[model samples]
Target: MESLFHPTGNQHILDRIDKLTPIKLSEWGVMTVSQMMEHCKMPLQVVYGTKHIKVNPLIKLLFGRRAKKQFTSAHPFGKGMPTAKEFKVNFEPDFETAKRELKELVEKFSREGKEGIKVTDHPLFGKMTYEEIDVAQWKHLDHHLKQFGV
Candidate 1:
């Protein structure tokens, strides 16, 4: 797993993020550029603070399996999984503002690093390691960025 704090990984991910434009359109996903920006927010919300959704047993049983495997491996997310309800942005988002927010959050996550971390319940995945969290984070953004043909 790439450490969120590692210079190479952090810089590389940030570079991809830096390339986003307000007018960017996805070649695949339904989300617009701003929606993609908001989608990026979900992982930041998980890391920077509390994830509002509590872990339920059944959800943990199903989504958790794929989530665990996702983190443990470098494999990119394939299309098909249901998008989280909260992350489904519907309103028009300020493009420049969203870009600014995305860049800042990635920087903050990198600076924080993985140290003495505790497992947190994901909306889908049950519990995730700090390493898993970092990899999951990078891969997710990478997937969407590629979706937008970035």
Candidate 2:
């Protein structure tokens, strides 16, 4: 699986992100390009200790392990999957600003590598290793980049 922790994969994702433009529209889903960029940043924020999500204990107990497996698997994320409310962008984001921030986060994620992740215990996915985080992050950004046809 391609991992953001590696230089090649990181550059690939950055190239795709650079292809995104203000006028680009999602091939599926409700989010505009800018909104998607903003949404993408949320998970990274959590990993970097800049954001927190409160998952219901019951939900975590019932679904956390299964969800973690799916997220870290080699298979790509399917379209129209349910998004966590915390990761959803309700307001419009500035296109250029969102793109810039997303790129910066992606770069930082790669540059710092596994040691950069500040939180390994996800609210809904339970405990994760650096490998799992890398796969999950790569899959997520790849999914969204593909969504925009970049």
Candidate 3:
């Protein structure tokens, strides 16, 4: 699995991200291109500790591992998957700004490495190791990038 912590993996994601344009159309899901860019920032915000997701213990116990496996697995996320409320981009976002911010966040995530990542519990997938988080993040970016047909 590719990881954001590795330079090559980070560059691969960045290259994919650069392919996105304001007029890009999603092959699936409800987000506009700009909204999708903004939506992409949510997970990084969580990693950076700017966003705190409260995980319900019951939910984690019931679904965490399953959810984690889905995200970290080689198989891609199916189209029109359910999104968490916090990840829903509700407002209009400036395309250029959203793109720039997401790119910066991706760069920051790559530069941070393991020591910079926060050890936080995912809302649906309990406590995760840095490696798991890395796989999940890359898979997420790949999934969305593919969604936009980039």
Candidate 4:
């Protein structure tokens, strides 16, 4: 599993993020460049503070095991994360700001280390540990980065 807290992994993603431009386009999903950046920042938003979260009991029962694998494995994420109502960034956000936010959040995670890592009630995954948080952060970012050939 790639730890964003590690220098190499952090550098890898940071470098990729730095390379992003408004001209970038995804190879798979339909998100615009701005939306993609907003998406990249979602996990961080969840960690730093809640923008929006909605986890219910049935959701926890269904997604709990899947969430566990995400914490410790190199498995690719399923298409589309469970989005929170508050995290949607749909106003044609500024590309420069999105890029900056993405880099900043990742850096915060790197600086925080494992102790810094923590997950709360996901809108779907219920109670998540930092382990679960790391995988989702990495996997989701990786998927989108690859989508844009970053």
Superposed by TM-score, candidate 1 places the C-alpha of residue 100 at a distance from the truth, in angstroms, of 0.6
Candidates ranked by TM-score? 2, 3, 1, 4
Q: Using lDDT as the measure, which candidate wins?
A: 2
The lowest-lDDT stretch of 10 consecutive residues in candidate 3 is 114-123
TM-score of 1: 0.86
lDDT of 4 by residue, 10-91 (tens): 8899999888889988787668888888877887777767455666678668876677566447778667655555566667
Candidate 4 minimal-lDDT segment of 10 residues: 115-124
Candidate 1: segments with Cα more than 4 A from true spot: 115-119
For TM-score, the strongest prediction is 2
lDDT of 3 at 28: 88
lDDT of 2 by residue, 44-109 (tens): 999998998899999999999999998999889999999998899999999999999999999988
TM-scores of the candidates are 0.86, 0.98, 0.93, 0.82
Query: How many residue pairs clash in all the candidates, one count each?
Result: 0, 0, 0, 0
Alpha-carbon error at 93 in model 4, in Å?
0.9
Model 4 earns a TM-score of 0.82
Whichever of 1 and 4 has more lDDT, that candidate is 4
What global local distance difference test value does model 2 have? 0.93
lDDT by candidate, in order shown: 0.74, 0.93, 0.86, 0.75
CA shift of 16, model 3, Å: 1.3
